[model samples]
Target: MILGYSVTDLVGFFAKGLDQVINVVIMFIFAIIFFGIMNDSGLFKPLVKRLILMTRGNVVIVCAMTALIGTIAQLDGAGAVTFLLSIPALLPLYKALNMNKYLLILLLALSAAIMNMVLGEVQWLV
Candidate 1:
């Protein structure tokens, strides 16, 4: 008001702020929709079964696979998307095998951290 800015200019500023975050918003929306569809269509069920078979009920292999899958999921560079992609897909295997849920969280976080660090370095180098 003191600077005599019009009301439309202030409203436009709000839109500009949204413009800065619109990509993130769209990413989250698409991630949710894509994962939700994949999940409901039973795609992850077979993948989980195959993972379980490959591990043969071995805790170490399961943990390693969790780390590997977490790293793959984190390639998208968004934690929510990573978790949405991994956690539900892995939870049944963890339950069936009686593994520690904390391990699930830890491995996912660590793998994601590593990927984020590596990608950051790559971006800086480029």
Candidate 2:
């Protein structure tokens, strides 16, 4: 018994959480489908390819641009969304140039952190 409730009475105690879990699963499913469609449409590949060429294989410029892009992507108000939009678009260039993937992640994370603080959203809410 829990707080005077019988075991049978507590059977449905966790049922509410299942609905929330299912909703999150459905949201992720739709997000994946959307990303797959965008990938197949050739929309992101060309943009990333062009940026790589324009940077002329310079790591400094690429890192700076990655930070900038990551920051701008955060305008959507979600860091996870920013990463989802930025990483896949930038990973190919990082791999092609033999750059450290961790560095790429660090730059984007730092940029996003700085932006979140400056914009007065995440911290202010706390």
Candidate 3:
């Protein structure tokens, strides 16, 4: 026999699903707004400027920095946390230098993977 779910049952199921993730959705919205406000207020501008001077507007420095930060951020062995730490810190620099965002992301991912392997290898060796 086919199961028939009434309107109330469907609505309840939908509400249950929404309730489970409503907090996350709200927090995500606030985070986006916060970052937007910071960007609009130019909070990252000075950081971008300093990075330009330190790296001398070098594309290779951006790549090198991305890899270093990615590896350091991955120390905790959490991809989400690593990306959260690396992306925001590097995105402004990449954009300021007119570099490709995809390249930043690709390099971050590769570095993080290498970091994970190195950590795992050390553990296995021990």
**Top candidate when judged by lDDT against the true structure:** 3
Q: Residue by residue across 1-126, what tens digits does model 3's lDDT show? A: 147988888899999999988976786677667777887899999999999999999999789989999999999987867776677778888988889999999999999999999999998999
The parts of candidate 1 lying over 4 Å away from their true place are 1-50
Total colliding residue pairs, candidate 3: 0
What's the lDDT for all of these models?
A: 0.85, 0.81, 0.87
TM for every model, in the order presented, reads 0.64, 0.64, 0.74
Among the numbered candidates, top TM-score falls to: 3
Worst 10 residues of 1 by lDDT: 42-51
Q: List clashing residue pairs in candidate 3.
A: none
- Give the range of the ten consecutive residues with the poorest summed lDDT in model 2: 7-16
Residue pairs with clashing backbones, model 2: none
lDDT tens digits by residue: candidate 2, 47-92? 7678778998899999999999989988766786787778777876
Candidate 1 vs 2: which has more lDDT: 1
Worst 10 residues of 3 by lDDT: 23-32
